[model samples]
Target: MNKPTLLFTAALLTAPALLALTACQPSGPVTNAPETNANSVTTLPISELPLHAEQATRLDNNLWLGVHPHGDIQIRDGQGALVGQQPVAAEFISQRRDAQGDFFLSLTTDNQLMFYRASAQGISDLHLSAELPWPLEGMCLYQPSAQELNLFVMDESAIAHQLLLTRTQGELLAREIRQFPLPPLAEYCVVDDSTDQLFVSEENIGVWSYNARAESEVLRKPVDLVKPWGALEHNTGPLAISQGQLLVAELGSDLLHAYPLDGGDTRTWQLAPIAAGQPLAADALTVSADSDKTVMAVLDDNNGKVYRAELTLPARAGDNQRIVQVAPVAETRPMRKSGDAADDPAIWVNQQQPELSRIIGTNKKYGLYVYDLAGNELQELVVGRVNNVDVRQGFSLKGQAADIAAASQRDRKAIALFSIDPLNGQVSTAGEVVTTLDNVYGLCMYRNITDNRFFVFINDQDGRFEQYEITDSSAGWRGKKVREFAVKSQPEGCAADDRQQRLFIGEEDVAVWTLSADAGAPTDMTQVAAVSDVLVADIEGMDIYRSDTEAYLVVSSQGNDSYVLYQAEAPYEYVGRFRVGINAEKGIDGASETDGLTVTSQALGADYPAGMLVVQDGRNLLPDENQNFKTISWDSIRAVVIAP
Candidate 1:
């Protein structure tokens, strides 16, 4: 039974702020309804079950399951007759029936989380499949794909845990992928896989919705509230979602509320008033619907009498936001420190042996890290606090041709340089060149295709950018400031296209601007893309993926944890956006709040035949390790966003 006492009102007195979260909008403006007669739609009790059970839910039109007083599960028909029973002991149960008529159950046994599977028609005999030692109050299952199943569990202290479950060699395994906080007294949770939405009921407050995708931000929006705040007369009770409506039961009333998942008016159903000898308490509820009819079941907590009813509801309206989802093929090792340690990544292609290529990443808190194609840490250069890094090949240093890498060393307020041996792929610190700016933040390197002259562009946090000509002489290497420019606001994460002689820079809170890569050419800036629905704010990383015939620019929309693609040529057309989702099979969590990224079109090996894109994973979850970089094959991205 739902807890009747509303003991969390003072803690949640800041209702104005919580109600303003717009990620999950309400069905519509809620109007207060009377307690005894709430826009009543009559519902008649079809049957009553005589059993001492705590909770009851409908499996199909003819079968229902409940927790009997004997600690086992009991099955009953629609006409209130006992049919079958399953002796599985469960303290709490959550059931879901997929489109294929397969039933999945999440049950809490003592402090362990267990999963059961059975056919909808044969639910009396369930197959115990998976179990994990998790002390959770409730659990809900979300299926991202046909083969990937994830469980979201609610603990006793109002915390949510997302775990990915897998099977290997007939053994089941569960691993924690992510975790987030929930409002105090959060009791019930249900997920709509079709809409990628998670609805959690706060006992003393209302129903809140969240984006169920593992890669999405943790933003909760209100669905409805209690009393003068919204529409309910008392605290919220059990919640069920079916046919696009979030069905909510009132904790201490005979009324039920149905809120359309999409925008629409709320509908209230008034159950028949209690008679002289009928069960009086409505504690648990279940709802299911098809194309033709909708059915609801309510459990009487005191006497274990089950009540069933039919509902006539309007059609469900759907306006779901759709985006492509893909997972990383590999991930680098965790950084040495936590927090925002990893900032940028640059890939170095080995011309002699593509498989021997390496990845260069900036550990802003420490120094630099070098990793091989298989994500093994090969070397570390402890220079200073480097923010962003870029790599270019074929630079003359000390009368020898070498690969050059540059990063904005914030600690030194200069440009940190490294020389990579082309033959052995070893990175050694060359030296640093102080900049005129007070603070150097972002850095990128470019080489002129016409004269093969190398240059590095460094930006300050105050929006000042200075281009320096990097030349090699007898005294190692030197940098001379050539041109200086500034944007209206802070800028970082710039990429240079050597083939097109163009440079692209992301103005953190503004738009992406393009200028000439040649130091002597005009520094006219052109707005390529602005912050919008697809391209969210705080645009961090920008890179170009160029093949022999086509090129596309990718930008990290840090505000939304998604990446937006565009045509790299003039009049850049918006292509699409995609998110790096969790790889349940490999146990690799997706990237979120990315800072800097790099991509190359040169084939590295069999794993990344069409090149790879490396992005800094700001919040690395699966095991909650330190921040690191993730590598995704370009072909995997093209298959979803660019395939025509």
Candidate 2:
């Protein structure tokens, strides 16, 4: 790898730039990235990339090569003289011949997929298609048949597999994504056009194959292809197919093994170095047919080297292709309204039956709307202007251990409390706690396991927040104000990390301030990401997603129509940020003006098996519809979190 270089290179801030949402603006110190706001992002001019051939291939009478990640992609003529070069940024690029015998390659720069077409005229830009949510490994283009070509990109984490429909395409389509499942992370993959199969090499596991088309089974299991080859614990290189044999590059051992799909014994070769005195440190591999000869190529990351050799063929391995990667999806709450109303959500996980879990959303128009993980509205409560909501399970409510939910009611200027039915996934109003603050807005739950008590922290539009404790009374549920906080401007989004005893509050036009979640605890606050820099004005919603080993804070940059993620604990390091871009598959629009968001790290159902992230969409339109809550799979967010 080209050692981690300048990341998030530039930082520019202006007053007018702060006024608009940074939906598409470059938000980081990206090296050489242009200053952008609300209009463009993920930019890299072809003239900026410097070319140094890390790998090279001879195809269509030309030499195609990829430079360093931040360097250029170059095309040279048959005489090995540079014909032309494109300052294209990419960590790696690989080429394959199309059915028409022309070559095409995928160049990945910062996880954004770029394509180049190689023909008799030389190499030309194809499309800078899919915006990968995270840095991933390997990519392939499949032509199940002529007139129907698709792009497949692998997620480096065990989160998801994506297919751009195309995230950006030619005269065919643009930015359509379909997501599917595969091994957590795939290091190498190749498409067998003859059998219409896609094979993904799962290091230490084995070679796995799947059908290239939709509706076909994907990543069922690994084919027992590597047991005879020996343990491939550090198989970080590539895999290729020529004729009936499969060529596997063992990077760790500096060896190459060819396995015949038939019953023949596997052949092994000690790979020759790209240069004298150097051993092969393969990063990628490719196999091609030159007339009756089989040619293979290897890319070395450590040495910036390229080597190619010819190989012998083996008999066909039968018709054994399975299925694999599709694009991602965007979903929203099923209920519709005449105007923007939906504000926040709270997820209740039914540990016994994952599918029975419910997503409780506050429809500011009237009350709390509950939906299944699939976005189907299950129930709605006319509780009067519920704005932001949150839930915490395993609470000792009235001496009974159950789940409790609360919301800030704007109309009543109170906190509406509900009892969650863990069994049937139903919710009913337990009671209400009228607050002293005017114009209630945001609310979150905190359960003190030490005292076995539950608390509700509610904030208002006037920048005042009160922490109240819910106690069981002989009459009904009553709340007592435990502590109070005040900020300089409007305050809305707030979340309490019961696990860490910390609370994060978003001061609309200011920044996120943190303090103790305990009653009577000192309010020594710390600023997280402030306005105009890490965040634009009106930092909206905040929630904490607790994974197995760590926790992450998810924030809605309402002013910019984007969501920012953080490490959640002290010294909250920024992970990354992403706007809920359009989901062409569902005809659903991305989110903007998000007021509140909530997350649950539990598999609610098959759709959200890893978990679900629910955010309120300020502008839920395209056909111009009213606002509602959009649900993004937490797995999608996890991909970015796990990315380098």
How does residue 15 of candidate 1 score in lDDT? 56
Question: What are the per-residue Cα lDDT tens digits for candidate 1 across 356-433?
Answer: 999999999889999997788999888879999999998878999899999999998899999999887899999988
lDDT of 2: 0.65
Model 1 CA deviation exceeding 4 Å by range: 1-86, 91-101, 108-112, 120-135, 144-147, 169-171, 180-184, 194-196, 210-221, 274-280, 312-320
lDDT of 2 by residue, 550-638 (tens): 68888887655567888898898877776565555565555667777888777777777677788876655444455677787777666
lDDT of 2 at 37: 30
Instruction: Score every model by TM-score.
Output: 0.87, 0.53
Best by lDDT: 1
Candidate 2 deviant stretches above 4 angstroms:
1-118, 121-330, 396-401, 584-588
- TM-score of candidate 1 against the unseen true structure: 0.87
